[model samples]
Target: MVGWLIDAIKKDYQPPISKVKVGKFNDYVQREYDFDKLEKKLLGWE
Candidate 1:
């Protein structure tokens, strides 16, 4: 297990999000999401 971990650490670990191409994630220019509704849904209030 230690040897495997060392080998894995030597390699470049690409996350799942690395494959996805997207625009500026934090850019709030056009107002894409309804954050109020999303918050309500997350809190089980919707």
Candidate 2:
């Protein structure tokens, strides 16, 4: 019963947005490193 309901919902659902673009690998790595440094500072890491 629950499985049937979930399947029906999945069949009917549609995403509103389309087209996701990712930046270059070097840019992503730099951004991630910056975020990690900020997070560590927030957590009081040395």
Candidate 3:
């Protein structure tokens, strides 16, 4: 449908920007303890 519309309109329609993939776990931290500030905050650390 989009291709047909583009062809009919004869206009260059730029597709939407691609999304950033973050679920691959490539940049994920395996150790939760590394986030000491968050752990402390959750533990009621002032």
Instruction: Give TM-scores for every candidate, taking all chains together and pairing residue i with residue i.
Output: 0.33, 0.27, 0.25
Q: What pairs collide in candidate 3?
A: none
In model 3, the runs with Cα more than 4 Å from the true position are: 1-34
Cα lDDT tens digits, model 3, 1-46, are 9888978677676778999875875776666465788788889984
Which ranges in model 1 have alpha carbons more than 4 Å from their true place?
1-31
lDDT of each: 0.81, 0.77, 0.76
Q: How accurate is candidate 3 locally (lDDT)?
A: 0.76
Of the two candidates 2 and 3, the one with more favorable TM-score, higher being better, is: 2
Model 2 misplaced regions, further than 4 Å: 1-33
14 in model 2: Cα distance from truth in Å?
A: 25
Candidate ranking (TM-score, best to worst)? 1, 2, 3
Q: Please report the candidate that would top TM-score against the real structure.
A: 1
For model 2 the local lDDT of residue 8 reads 77
Query: How many clashes (backbone atoms < 3 Å, residues ≥3 apart in a chain or on different chains) does model 3 have?
Result: 0
Error of 2 at 27 (Å): 20
The worst-scoring run of ten residues by lDDT in candidate 2 lies at: 24-33
